[model samples]
Target: MVDLQVQYQQLKGEIDRALAAVLDTSHYILGPQGQAFEAEAAAYLGVKHAVAVASGTDALHLALRAAGLGPGDEVITSPFTFIATAEAIAYVGATPVFVDIDPQTFNIDPELARKAITARTRAILPVHLFGQPADLAPLQAMCDEHGLLLIEDCAQSFGATYAGRQTGSWGALGCFSFFPSKNLGCYGDGGMVVTGDDRLAEQLRMLRNHGSKVRYHHDIIGYNSRLDEMQAAILNVKLRHIDRFNQLRRQNAHYYSERLADAGVVPPREDGKGVHVYHQYTLLTDRREAVQQALTTAGCASAIYYPIPLHRQNVFAAAFGGVSLPVSESVAARCLSLPIFPELNQEQMDRVVAAVRGA
Candidate 1:
């Protein structure tokens, strides 16, 4: 379905040298490599500060904590994302307010979000699900009108832009993940929290540490979520090629779209402001189970972004008061993520389309 080995071999020497440099430095935790990566990432996102963290999940937690989310606070967000989005909110003892998704973009529905806000709502965490940026304008306005924070869960759309700005920069705090399979994946687990407010940025830096900017002097309760220097080194190498890699993924997506035209599937959303990085060229179809079976039989692979909506999950069932989100439930049942990556060749893409068409 996809391949990362080609990239490893293509940049083997650089990676080897980078890894060796990490071993030589002996300053493994939040070392120079991590600092260098932070600057690079901040520049890439056009933000003032980028705090590297342990993983994408940690990025969310740090962002929430920095924004002052805690027990009794409510964060309105869609239920159609990876569990991490809700988990981050719950980590701080906050309630994850459930909302439905926009039928077209598979992102949080702004109208639903507007309806869900209340006095308890302290933040609105809109996810850029499946590489598509959520509509931010209205959501931002809602936050402004109600004095709520905006956090973007950009785990999939690391390089995606919205309305002339990076996806992560649109909100108060933009969180990212560099898991092994993301569009800008590292060698292992890594994450970052990007923000423009200098005060919030400073808080994130301190929070990732033990709530203290200086050593051995804790200011408040915090967690150890620092990014690994070695992983940062590896990501630095990959960051240099992410734009080119995204370009290839875009090209492959076009090929897949053209081939799947007759397969009775609604393609991923591609609109004016943002570019779908093909994080997963997902399609909407009722024949999800049959499609998966056929793709597997045809020597291909596929997946579902989520099989259950967050509101229905056991952890949140008792928190969200049995929220009814029809759109989220429907999308979860029908959506299928196809094999997509920069290295996916035309032949493989053709096989994927044919498998879906045949199914």
Candidate 2:
């Protein structure tokens, strides 16, 4: 949907220079560029430490492993998310307990999360779906009451904020993706884990690199997951303009909201304290399939953030045991994402609105 051609054209020179520098150094993995990017990312997110990894899935996996979560441990998370959120839990041999989402924000319903917690509940992994921040106050309160860690699946939210703070900093650990489709994406797979606690950050670092604080001396069983120097270099270049790009996305979202406000579609609702980046401008309507197809036929790209809820997914259903959540199922069927990016203009937005309403 996004014209990445335009994006690269604008930032081509800087990006090429960054890549050339990394290649000339002959250091491709976990080199100077990765370290510099990590520092900048941590500072931007206002967190103490940031660990770069291979992908958001690895970020979630390591975040959970670093916290000492393993088999038999139950993690409370919303079922209305991409499979990766629950898949990470399953990868760590942890139980993926399903929770419903708030009808408005489509984030984990804290009440449902609290209800899902038990002696086995080790963490609450809330996915910030479609770039909206989850309600943190209630989630934090529940986690505190139950002594559970909070890991935010921030794959969709990079610039989004909750209560004036970034989305990734609210929980114990925030896992972010740098997939090409994301707000601050790299050329290929990249991810980072941000944490306020120094000890936890240390654990995460060790986990990402063969569980060794010192080279070649293993402290615990870990995996091989590192942010390649090339991807890190590219991300650093993109980081400079991320704020402006997100602002443009916000303006485009406003245009769509104004035009489609009365198109029998429910637009996203932002929290008073949350600065939504509009990574994906999604809407709810009974005619989601028709609307999406109509937009595509009309030359406006459209997609569904997730067509299947996690609870119903065969993998999660087999691993997490049984659960019945109505809200999540409904959202999976109705929510649709339109072409939303920093480069999209008012004219394109008007056409998308027209297609949807016309459908």
Give the runs in model 2 whose Cα sits over 4 Å from its true position: 319-322
| Candidate 2: residue 347 Cα off by (Å) | 2.6
lDDT (10s digit) by residue, model 1, range 57-168: 9999999999888999999988988899989898999988888888888898899899988889999999998788889999999999999999999999988888878889
What is the Cα-based TM-score of model 1? 0.97
The digit string of per-residue lDDT tens for model 2 on 144-240 reads 8888898999998998898889989989999999998899999889999999898999898888898888999999888889999999999999999
TM-score of every candidate relative to the true structure? 0.97, 0.96
Per-candidate Cα lDDT values, in order, are 0.88, 0.88
Clashing pairs in 1: none
